[model samples]
Target: MTFGGLPTRWEPPGASRGVALVAPGRSYPPTAPLLDFTRVALLQHGFTVQQIWWDSLTRGEEEPEAWVRRHVAAAHAREDADRVLVVGKSLGTLAAPYAAERGLDAIWLTPLLTDPSVAEAVGANAGRQLLVGGLADALWDASVARELEEGGCQVLAVPDADHGMGTRGAVRTAEIHLEVARAVEAFLAGAAAGAGA
Candidate 1:
């Protein structure tokens, strides 16, 4: 997706601890539940958030890595946030390297493990990052996920869930979402604390 549009900025009063930049997946709205939940979590942990604007490019069009890099890096630099946390999904996993180079932590949802560069960037990032993916996802790699875990990444591998972390039935989907929320909350909390430390 092309990084175009106005960012949704949220600054909680007295927020002094850190900041978060949310990068969303291709074709997904920036107001997705995942981003909403993360915004609240970050606010509760005293972090300001900027939900980056996104508009998907044509399928045959190349993913705009340079555009993403310029925007994310510029935003991060402008904020001068000490304890930065990046949250992304699917194609947004492209930001891993930018975050990594800045020594920042991140949470990657439905990461593009099919891309060696994405996997390597996520795996090599210094902090103990969090990854969420389902076995049914075409882009997911269980071996690579395991390897990432072994190398300090935390993975939440869901059974029978697809690329969007969705299953067949409504009940199962809700269950998976609940589990994801719990994991994300814990991960963000821990990372914020660690950054404070």
Candidate 2:
């Protein structure tokens, strides 16, 4: 699918209760297991998944948040969606403010917690959110994650995992991917329930 002329991949399920938008990292493709896991979890939770594919955004020559915001706005307009859940990876975490400002639920994997703007967004967001980061990842900040949790954001911290949440090899990587998937499913379920509150 295409949103605002940007290449996008959509996993739309019948009778979906909501929409899920995934913004992947500069290096990670939408098909990455972490993202794929998100897709599966959203589908299982009755949410459609709309993923923005790489184009110029993959170059990293320019900042991604602007492009992210634009694509999100376009996707929302195109889908005419009322309930949206934004999910992001490393560089994609820059979209936290857009999600926050819009009051949309979100899942941030390996977020760039070191950035004050990102921290501030998660801190001030009023909508349901899940934050996952790793201690091994330089971009991950334990204090910030704890602060977001204190502010009502659900958080998951993986030990010995890097920015991609990889434990080292394929075996361990797949294992962590499973863990993240299960966590996301639970998070989505909780967020869905919270929307009714």
Clashing pairs in 2: none
lDDT of 1 by residue, 1-197 (tens): 23355448888778567788888888765677666776777777778887776565643355566666666777677787667888888877788888777667898888888888888888779866889989999999999999999998989999888987888898988788777888888987787667669
lDDT of the candidates, in the order given = 0.79, 0.82
Over all chains combined, what TM-score does candidate 1 have?
A: 0.89
TM-score on alpha carbons, each prediction = 0.89, 0.89
Query: RMSDs, each prediction?
Result: 3.1, 2.9
Model 2 spans > 4 angstroms off: 2-13, 56-62
Tell me, by lDDT, which candidate is best: 2
Per residue, candidate 2 scores C-alpha lDDT tens digits across 1-197 of 67567545555567878788888887886778888878877887888788876565355655667877776677677675678888888877888999888888889999999999889998888888889878899999999899889889888898878888987699988887787887898897787676678
Consecutive 10-residue window with the lowest summed lDDT within model 1: 54-63
